[model samples]
Target: MTANTSKSTEGAHEPGGFGALRRLHLSYAGEVQGVGFRWASKLTAERVGCTGWVRNEPDGTVTQELQGTPDQIATYFGAFSRVFAAHPIEYVIAEKSDISPIEDERLFTVRF
Candidate 1:
């Protein structure tokens, strides 16, 4: 008897679960630097099984690129929002750009 793997593998190999992958480019302004924002973002992405990178800008902004399914991406934002809301520092979204998803991304990382 041969074990069929096709049914068990459906949507698991796809980027977003339904073959619809999305990329989110976000820029946050305000008290973002030196507040463990990048660390929080990294953890959130990892927890949601998303792939991408995040970095701090010279102008006191945090930029992130996340790629995954709509649900995964939404979860990532929800996590980040909770982190930011917990801090006393003021936070605001400066920019938000959705781009074409990259097919080769495999893991989330913090960019230096």
Candidate 2:
């Protein structure tokens, strides 16, 4: 896990200020690829006001790097998990790592 060096004073609940932002690297395995996981993750991140990217790995995993407040990040994950559960996509959290937050992120996107 990288150190949290965010200097922004914006609170997590604030509209534009990503208060106490953090970055997370997450990988999902087991039927994650080709299951609309990346698209669903992108939607969840956008809805939660997170900035980062998700992609499909060649090893049949779905990998994503997301940046947001702790609560927002949790919410994003919850949303994704709910979708997976409802649809039964065989998704499993394989790994997670905390990373240094990028200071100037403006939007969440999906990377191919």
C-alpha TM-scores of all predictions: 0.77, 0.79
For residue 56, give model 1's deviation from the true position in Å: 0.8
Off by over 4 Å in 2: 1-18
CA-lDDT, candidates in order: 0.75, 0.75
lDDT of 1 by residue, 1-112 (tens): 1111122222233444654787767777777789898898889999998999999988778888888888887888777667756455677666666677788899999998
In model 2, the Cα lDDT at residue 60 comes to 83
CA RMSD, predictions in order? 12.0, 7.2
Scored by TM-score, the top model is 2
Model 1, backbone clash pairs (residues 3+ apart or across chains), number: 0
The sequence of per-residue lDDT tens digits that candidate 2 reaches over residues 2-96 is 22222333322334454677877778777777778788888888988899999888888878888988789879867766776666765566777
| Candidate 2 local Cα displacement, residue 13, angstroms | 17
Clashes of each: 0, 0
